[model samples]
Target: MPLDRRSLLLGSPFLLSGCVTSPATQRPSQAAISRPDMVEADYASIYAAVDGEPFPVPAIDLQEIEPEFLRRAVGYRTAERPGTVVVDPGERYAYLVGEGGRAIRYGIGVGKEEGFNFRGAATIARKAQWPRWTPTPDMIRREPQRYGRYAGGLAGGAGNPLGPRALYLYRDGRDTLYRLHGTVEPWTIGTMVSSGCIRLLNQDIMDLYRRVPVGSRVVVLGSGGGTAV
Candidate 1:
């Protein structure tokens, strides 16, 4: 008997070893790991896949996200106070909206203008590791070149831009037509760059995802929207 490729993918969350590689290419080193049908991913491999290789001249250390980094984080917010995230596009900072008039801030990458921009309130409905991608029909219809190829859907693993994890957002108990997902493009951390979906570095998004869970609260101050994450 032979283990199918799908089985290898849909296996356990702990399947990956503690090696955070990008989710774009499967290096030979990855095949060495074992599988229990499907297991929990160590998350390291996913980083390797989507993350660009370190260059000869490192752009920026950016290894550790310090308080200064928070100052650079972009998202929507009204005032600084702990509660839920309230993304304010006008300011480009996703304020964790802290308590006692403070917020754990994080820079964010927003969508481009027009079709790429969307405003609404939602919650972190669900999450996944190396989540498969099935572009919405609207996305395909709007830009077939970018999505027609994957109409059937994209499987989890290296090459999927969603990186290590995904924080699915919902509104009115339905997918709010957006997501706060991880990306390999780390430099885009604090800018508008997606189709209304919030993008974060694999490391940062992973960090945020860990802190929040399904049903957690999220308030997108952009265009006045709020919900539970």
Candidate 2:
């Protein structure tokens, strides 16, 4: 049986530690309100692809996801300026700080174990649509049987693991090799299952990619609650 929203929210440690309740009367910003698909969308409407999107993003079944993982407006009290993207891996949530005291929150899948320990500030140096995927040398060495086939690279497509979009992370002038990208398996949202990549639902990522520019700041907090950079 598929995991329901209530079951996952009640059972998942991330949700317990991560979710903060906001007053019902706080309204979303103009930008948030404009996205009816995100602000007030049902599962079916939320899952539908936006017109003229460069890549294919298949509609997803909302029942397959925990409700908390769905994109929504939240009262986020953060010092970070608006347009900054802060990822709390422990909470399995990504916050796009907005004007006022609110944020556009999106559910995400994070890396396992130490992969969650990645702490620091980086800039989104590049963005891609239907980006190609390549396994790192360490990834291939660790699991050659699983990754060797993609030793060269995998073309972007509906079946590509990177899904429809990718935001490359960089620090100083170097590529951190960490990415904020979409996933083919939306069911994996709110879980620890990636190789240090931050995973978002295809639809959610498309929205984020459009709003987040190449020079946007990305702060990934540490497990110890210390800010990275």
Candidate 3:
């Protein structure tokens, strides 16, 4: 069958291959590897689709999501060479510039005003599947009651706010402490709610996670936002 978004997002977690960590070592439980299906589920149940399945993306209501935010290929003209990631935060889109004046675009959720803007160049230093999350010291200090419990770290899982994948950004070989990662809340896409990380819908993040190579270049435009890979 011709590949569709559902197949790309819902068929195989290994669709791209070589990006996954050993399940035995990364997942907290077997259930995290294979879980239940999501059927006509509400937004709250979205996490059920991603909890621990080998193919963890769930079908979301496209009608509810803006068409521009959905992943698609488009004719794009840019000076940046192919394989570069360009993020336009003001417009809320991330583009993977491809060969021949084309680009793959995905809608993104950005950080709030405090974490909303940064300018400069960075590289994809690392990638992780279902990455562990630690509330930053700044985050804890700002909201202790909310972030204190997870200060040490939260294991990768559906319940973890980072969702199923993370691309760590680096500049000059130093960690930026920013990430482009999956979000448990699909509805959050195309919004600005996060502290500093760039968030994509879980399925979209997985799609992006597979395409981006380690050491890829990422450019955040104007006052926009993006992690790295």
Candidate 4:
């Protein structure tokens, strides 16, 4: 993913650590918005080619930025710590466990391989916006039919598959074959998608990327799951 200088910050107060700040309602000077498909040329296209006709994004029924979903604990317990991200692929939920047993959880899309999905612990090593997407060689090899279009490289923007933002996950100072990034095909959210990367709706990711900071710890679990550094 080509993460450049793009920026995002969710509005409203961050409720944490017994301290209540004002709602983080302030938008950045440059709010990123997805481009339309019907526009003309010369806009750094970054979309994957469709084998058939393109389908409109499906209507996702879930809580969005406003009126955040009131989640019920899945009868799950933990050592009970905050400031950590735990991803449970079986539940398709990423819980940002917060103070007082509260968590800001969101639905996520995971990899297809059972145990090969990212798990363990890591941090937000880096992040970018409208990031240039370079499909890993393995991804190309796995699905040449789908990825051959970018045998070379693809710029960022409309056709770009990385959507709007990309948060790179790293462990042991090495690149994990995983990423938290925006999805152009919003319908893919809450489904088994991606060769390995974790995906979110463009709008949702845009909202998340803005709230999280670099070096935030993340723990992934599922399939042949092994936790990251």
Which candidate ranks first by TM-score, i.e. highest? 2
Query: What would the per-residue lDDT of candidate 4 be over residues 1-229, giving only the tens digit for each residue?
Result: 3212121011222111101111111221222222111112211111122212232322233333222221222223445356566777766666665555455555566664554466678888988876666645654565576445655766657556666678888999987857787665454456655556676755446546765778888887644432221
lDDT of each: 0.50, 0.69, 0.62, 0.51
Model 1: what TM-score?
0.60
Tens-digit per-residue lDDT, 34-115, candidate 1? 2211212333443243234231111223553332333322232344234466665544556555434444455676665544
| lDDT of prediction 3 | 0.62
Error of 2 at 187 (Å): 0.8
Ranking by lDDT: 2, 3, 4, 1
Q: State the displacement of the C-alpha of residue 221, model 1, in Å, after optimal TM-score superposition.
A: 2.0
- Global CA lDDT of candidate 2, please? 0.69
**Candidate 3 ranges beyond 4 A from true positions:** 1-56, 223-229
Winning candidate number (lDDT): 2
Model 3 lowest lDDT segment of ten: 15-24
State each model's C-alpha RMSD to the native. Answer: 12.7, 9.1, 12.6, 14.8
Give the better candidate number (1 or 2) by lDDT: 2
TM-score for candidate 4: 0.61
TM-score of each: 0.60, 0.78, 0.72, 0.61
Off by over 4 Å in 4: 1-77, 141-149, 223-229
Error of 3 at 107 (Å): 0.2
